[model samples]
Target chain A: SQKIEQNSEALNIQEGKTATLTCNYTNYSPAYLQWYRQDPGRGPVFLLLIRENEKEKRKERLKVTFDTTLKQSLFHITASQPADSATYLCALDVRYGQNFVFGPGTRLSVLP
Target chain B: EAGVTQFPSHSVIEKGQTVTLRCDPISGHDNLYWYRRVMGKEIKFLLHFVKESKQDESGMPNNRFLAERTGGTYSTLKVQPAELEDSGVYFCASSQDTGSTDGYTFGSGTRLTVV
Candidate 1:
């Protein structure tokens, strides 16, 4: 069965440190991947997107890397702060544009 | 420009009752989509609409769920004879182009509870 998995456990990191989250999948080849941030009572907001041909995509303090050979994507938040604490989700563009599959998501908490 | 909007934000209904959820996409976005996440599960796609046309509905669970996009603007999802397992958060998303690259804008979602 095809599956997309992210660390279901909450990740805690010291303030100003780098927080890394991993997303792995099996039995599927996606053209691209996207990362999103979701806060309580709010919808997910798009953060970054990386294509299969791209090794890394970065914006400000956020970075995403996609390794199709490993079927994995890593999301990193640099200089993490309390405001960056939220559930992070990785999604695959299944069937190109028609549908999407999201990972269970990983919760990150930056401690002071 | 406003983002995608959904209403009501939350709904609580008894089993067998019918409920309608609405979604207003960003202006000029011809593509709209519906998705849901049950407890402890990943968000799953329900369907997609392109300017009042059903592009893909392979994710619709059963016949009890009916979705409509009126005048290629706002969309509605109706679940009749709801079941206990229908409890989940329904999300609406829209994009100007196919979501292969730029991500779609998402609504806050309507949390539905069936007792």
Candidate 2:
């Protein structure tokens, strides 16, 4: 069976510190990977996307790295803030213009 | 520009009853999609639509669930004889074209409770 796994179910870190989340998958080769942020009682919002050929992608304080060899992607939030606290999800895009298979997601809490 | 909109923010109905959920994608967005997240599970894709046609619906759980996008405008999902396990959040999203570059905009979603 194909699977996409995040590093942890919940992660807690102090504000201003850097937070790192991991996504791993098995039995599938994805052309691209995307990350999304979902708040409680709301749908997910698109964040960052990285292609297999690209090693890393960055958007302000957020950064993402993809390693197809390992079938893993890492998401980092530098200078994390309390407002960044939410569930982060990683999804695999097998087809460029198609649907995504999302990971279970990791809840991040940036404590003040 | 207005974002994708889903109606009936929440609905609670008994099992075996029928329920219909509607989604209005952003204007000019021709690609519409349906996704769902069940209790304690990751969000899963249900179907995708391009204009008035069903582009892909392989993720649909069963035939009991029907999705239609007539005239390529808004879309609707109807669950006939809803089951207890159908209780979850249904989300609708749309994009101008394909790929992550054109990020998909998702609606707030509708919470369905099958009692």
Candidate 3:
């Protein structure tokens, strides 16, 4: 079975600063990867997806990078705000999105 | 368009009791998936339903869990004689096709607590 790892420690940063979170996996590489934002008591909402062939993708202030060689992905929230405070999860999809194997998630807090 | 919707936002039941969680996927979606997250743990896949059939149920923990997607419209997950360890948040998600390029849409989830 594949295993996904993320920082368990909560990350605290000042609002307006950039927040970077990492996701790493072991075993075979996935066909694609996705990032999600989960608010307290709510399910994860889709943020972005990057295929193995894609090095980087950006949507507004959100950016995601995929480094298959390192078996890692980085999620960045630029110009972060208090609203960005939530648990961010990275999911690995194999066999053409059968679909997802999610990491434990890293809770980020943007302080005002 | 409405995203996935789960009934009974919260459920509290006693051990040895039964609880049923309902999930209605987005209209026209052919794939539905169920996942659960225990307190302080990672979210784990339970099963996947393609239309009215179970495509993969390898993640279902034990025989105590039953899932159905009759008519391929809505789905139900029943935990029979729920145990204390069954306490967790159940999430339902849906995608239009097998290869979900748009990503899956998840519901708010049903929080289940067994005492």
Candidate 4:
């Protein structure tokens, strides 16, 4: 089975600073990786997706990078705000499977 | 458009009891998925339904868990003789197709507690 792991359980950073989160996987190389933000008492919302061939992708202040060679993906939020504080999850679809596998998620807290 | 919706926002059942969770996907979506996240654990895929057909259910933990998508509109996951380990937040998601670009829209999820 494919397994995914986030860089940390929780991360705390200042509002103006950038927050970086990592997702690592083992066993297979996914064609695309997705990032989602999950707020308390709610489901996750899609943030960004990066393809294996693409080194980086950006949506406003959010950026995601896929490093297949390193078997990892990094998610960054620039000029973070308190609103950005939430649990972020990384997910990948198995090439041979119908469902996606998700990492445990890293809870990020942006201090004001 | 309305997002996916799940029923019984929360459930509490005694061990060995039966519990059923329901989900209604967005209109016209062909792909509906069931996922669960145990306490302190990552969300895990449970099964996938494509227009009333079971595309894949390999993630289903055991025979005690049964899922049905009748009429290709709504889905129900019934767990008979539920165990403590079955307690988790069950989430339903849907998409027009399997394309990663479209992304999947998720429901608020049903939190289940088995004691």
Q: Which candidate wins on lDDT?
A: 2
Model 1 lDDT tens row, B1-115: 9999999999999999999999999999999999999998988999999999999999999999999998999999999989999999999999999864668899999999999
Task: Give the Cα lDDT of each candidate.
Answer: 0.93, 0.94, 0.93, 0.91
- In model 3, which runs have C-alpha deviations exceeding 4 angstroms? none
Cα deviation of B62, candidate 3, in Å: 1.0
Better of 2 and 3 by TM-score: 2
Look at candidate 2 and tell me the lDDT of residue B25.
Answer: 98
lDDT of 1 by residue, A1-112 (tens): 9999996668999999999999999987988899999998888899998888999999999999999999999999999999999999999987677888999999999999
Give lDDT tens digits, candidate 2, residues B2-108: 99999989999999999999999999998999999999999999999999899899989999999999999999999998999999999999999988475789999
Rank by TM-score, descending? 2, 1, 3, 4
Every model's TM-score: 0.98, 0.98, 0.96, 0.96
On a 0 to 100 scale, what is the lDDT of residue A11 in model 4? 98
Please state the error at residue A64 of candidate 1 in Å.
Answer: 0.5
| lDDT ranking of the models | 2, 1, 3, 4
Number of clashes found in candidate 2: 0
Candidate 3: docking tier: medium
**Docking quality (DockQ) of candidate 1:** 0.79
lDDT of 2 at A8: 100
Share of native C-alpha contacts between chains A and B (below 8 angstroms) recovered by candidate 2: 0.70
